[model samples]
Target: MNKILIVSQQGLARSTLKTALYGEHIVIEAGSAAEAMARAQEYRPHLIVLDMDMGGENSAEICMTFKEHDATSYIPLILLSEQGQKDDIINGLHAGADDYITKPIDPIELLARIDTHLRTKEYFADLEKSDLLMLFELIDIISVTRNPKKILDIIVEKVSCYTEVSRCSIINIDIDGNLAVVASNDLKKNQKITLDLKNYPEIENALITKRPVVLEDLGSNPLMAAVKDKIKHIVNESIVVVPIIKKQNVIGTFFLRTVSTLKGDRAERMNKLCQIVANISGNALENAVLFETLQSNKNMLENLAIRDSLTGLYNHQYFYARFEEEFSRAERYASPLSCMFIDIDDFKKVNDTYGHIAGDLAIRKISLMLNQLLRKSDIAARYGGDEFVLILPSVDQAQARSLAERVMTMVREVSVPQLYGQRITVSIGLATYVNKNYTSYEELLHYADAAMYRAKSAGKDSIFVTG
Candidate 1:
């Protein structure tokens, strides 16, 4: 039940108000300003009715006191004055009276005014509840995704939907004062655009103050004077920028623009919501940045473990591991698998004539050529210095020989500019597993290596195949 406090020195006036409000509300009466303040603080009434006649107790000052006190500030205050006391009525309202009733008070008008203020209070209460619920929902939704881009996108999308703004965006400002629109309601996810900080004076002010900046009228706001001409064509009439702060520093802002002019209670509510969201965004962005950094470090460590630092190909240990698995699969399924061993001819001569650096360059060039010629399923790795190995799945002897010929032709065509335009060649040996009774994949690799030595014996830059 709502509590109403009626302050009047006259017994007749207090009785009249109580009689009218008795059944609908619980009425508390105070005969003086001091007693009225005591009752107001004790009961914490939903509304206050103060008679301006106060027996010369400065009724307007009493009203101002109630409006200023934290406990009674939000309680609705109505002033009762004589019918023609225009100055008293004006003074009461100016002193923060929410409403007023005349000395010859009409019971119906009194009831109606009281009900209006009570309904407005209920509405503001509901709005506060709804805002809190929306904030919780937003936090829940953004917390489930680990992608930094998606998290920012969700924030702007939710804010835009709730605020119904012309534009809602999360902009990140770096230490260099560069602004980047990390996410926007109108843009695709992961799409970012750079913006000049000077163009957005409201955002710049918010960042400087580390507080929310609101401009209800862009045309009239002094902060927007510099950009007034540039934004003259824009239909938006209001803008709000709430800084997202982290560790006492302003990292970014929740930028919003709307066509409607937000003022009074509506503007205050919007500012409160955006400030709460900015606090939440700061924590969310921090977690996302940390997650991305950890994920990047993890991937870097994994790559270093399995990748050749020089050629960027799979290292020898990783190649052997994969070879074991592929050979087992091929044997189990009775599928054809080919292996090739390539040895660069006179690789030591290049190292001796030029340097080991040129030798490394030549090896890198051949590695690149192999990578370009091979299919996705083919695996190539540097088995050792100047010696490379390949494993081709689902390839027969004819296919393996064809691939070896191509590798020789490409390698012959490659000239090392560091070797003073000298061309180099490779001896390649191809071995295919069809019906061969190879005990293990190692046996197949041995056959290919033996054939490569035979190619070196016969002539350089030749391919030899072992049955």
Candidate 2:
């Protein structure tokens, strides 16, 4: 509830003023300037009503004292003057009284004026609370995610939801001065669009000035004249562009467009909020950029560790790790698992006739073929020079044989440009673990390898199977 203080020398006047504000406010009364000051300091009232009819003391001087004092300066003061006391009202106003009421006070007018000031104060308080809440939420988002794009997208979405704008976007400017929409509430996921700087003069101005630029009217604003005709069909009524600065440089902008014209406190509140958000965004974007760089480098290093650099397939170590996991899963589920060992026939001949580079090219081509033919559940990796391994889960002997024949057919069709139209073939050994006595993945792989040598002894291009 709001608090009101009434100061008047006459006890009757104080009672009258108290009655006027009764029930709606917590009213305190004092009969002298000194007592009023003491009561005001104690109560910290939202408003003060001072009757200028103090017989001896200077009421205007008292109002000025209250206005000048740091503790009471923010309190709204209403001066009550006798009828036709124009000089007194003028003096009270000049002494920093917020409003005036001529004697024979009307209760309705008193309530209306007081309510106006209170409402204005409340509006500003709510705006402050909202701004703090938004900043807290943005900080939370930054702490939880390392993906810069995800962070930018969430920021734009939250801003749009809070501000109720027609469109809200985060634009990034590259070192070459190229502008792109990095994240926007209006766009699809992962969608990005390049922008022509000339079309967005407000954003350009904000960048150039390293400050905010607001276009209240798109049609009449001089900054938007170049694109007025181009955007005639757009429904946006205003635009606000705030530069995101980092270490004295403009990295990007927060671009907002509204369908309704913002005026008075609405406009001021929006501009203030945008400026604050831009400030927070500067630091948030910097952290996100750094985090993204580190994350990218970490991923690249991990990829190198687990992948074969030459053929882009799983390396020997990764294959063994995955094979053991798959084998355990198949054993636990009582599911069939097939292992295949493949040796390229006469691979050394290609290297001798052409070069090692040609041999590497042939290996890459075969790897690509294997990748294309394998199911999502199948795993293929280059085991060593001229050798490849495969793991097919839930595949029995018949299915394994069918897959081996398919691989043989594809190998015959493979042609390396470096080989000068020389066709390549592979000898594949297939083993199924359903009825085999193998106790470990290594035993299964060894059996497949031994079967591959038997196929080699039988002929160069063939398939050998063992349980």
Candidate 3:
């Protein structure tokens, strides 16, 4: 049912394969590598059995040429070499041989290898159809979510479920060009999981090739010699690294590590699924990143509207807006509401004598002291130039007057070192809402303003109270 190409320079080895494969397959024999390539181009055999020792180009070189050819790469090639040519066998495998058979090859063993490759091809064909359906499901999942953490979790979960790897991790390349584990499943405890592209040449190769890098066994790789002990201590067996590509750049990596060797069909399946997840996740991640940046910018713009530029206190407009809400709450609860109108004593003289910068420094210091002194529920705001307002929700006339005296003492002690140790003082006017007289916010504001004028007339640094 399948076409098999036998490539051997020796007539004896070629006849041996043809006799063994006779009626089972349509056996096509070639006596040399050149004839094998020409017949392979014409016949397009399902599999190739090449003799390693008796070849024009060595079996490994021929294997590499076959793998590099676009048309012949998919056709599985098994190398037949001498009994003790272990090095040549390894070289052949590295050159991309699907399987290897040794000379004095048993007829049953060689046929079994052929059957394995054929079955694997059939299994992969089925997996392709199923993988296509899975890809659509992944695309649908990406469409509904904008949260980056949520999306990454879904990716890790899906990859783990679809491909039964011992452990899986999605390593993100951050803005700083460092790799961090965004999501992982079944990661080893106490394992120092660190992967940098610079440190791992195999991983770097995967990124550059934009393809999967499969290391069937870490023990056999010379390139992994530097990190062999470290890898053996951690993963030790096999790892499949696939690059998550976006716009010709590797944004991240999908790593699957296992104790079992990943080879042939299993490796191909994992690589295919990795590419699917990488393609779908790249755009979803980008969208989530953009959304986070936009949200941060939006919050900053909203803060700019209500926050004072210099003192970092609430501005006059926002103070009025908050006052209305606090006033309504106090009225509904029948709570005592008090407001203090504070004016800096001789503020105009300070600005003229010390300069505007020193005046700003004084304002900032006062604001910082207010923030430290005020209760969480109390509101403090810069009403306008050289004046501030405080709203206390549950304070009566007696309490307001006591608080005002303490504030007067504190303001007098508030000296600005930047202004040559200039001491600042303030005149306070307090207004308490009486049960029926101060029914409206406007009435309370007017009473506080009147009290402030009275305090100014009586003395520059004093407190005046009105109900």
Q: Work out the TM-score per prediction.
A: 0.38, 0.38, 0.37
Per-candidate Cα lDDT values, in order, are 0.78, 0.77, 0.73
Q: Which pairs of residues collide in model 1?
A: none
Global CA lDDT computed for model 1: 0.78
Give per-residue CA lDDT, model 2, range 1-467, as digits (tens). Answer: 79998999888888777887888899988888889889988989999999999999998999999999888999999998885476888999999999887655556556755764565444545365656787789878866776767877878877777774777788876533457888888899899999987787777665544456666757887888888898786525766776665532212334433333665566667765776676567677767765665676777657657877667678888999999999999889889999999999987788767655456667877888899999998988889878999999999889999999999999898775447778888888988888546789999999999999889988869999985
Instruction: Name model 2 segments beyond 4 Å from true.
Output: 1-298
In terms of lDDT, the poorest run of 10 residues in model 3 is 248-257
Candidate 3 residue 277 C-alpha distance from true site, Å: 46
Error of 3 at 137 (Å): 47
lDDT of 1 by residue, 1-467 (tens): 78999999999999889887978899999999889989998999999999887887998899999989998999999998885576888988999998887655556457756865776533445256667777888899877666767777777777777774667778876433467888888888778899987788877666544456777767777888898898786524666677665532212334433333566677667766776687687777767765775687877657656866557677778888888888898898999899999999998788767654356668877888889999999999888768999999999999999899989999998765557778899999888887756767898899999999999998878989988
Q: Report the C-alpha lDDT of model 3 over 347-411, residue by residue, as the tens digit.
A: 88887676543566678778878888888898888886688888888888899899889888887
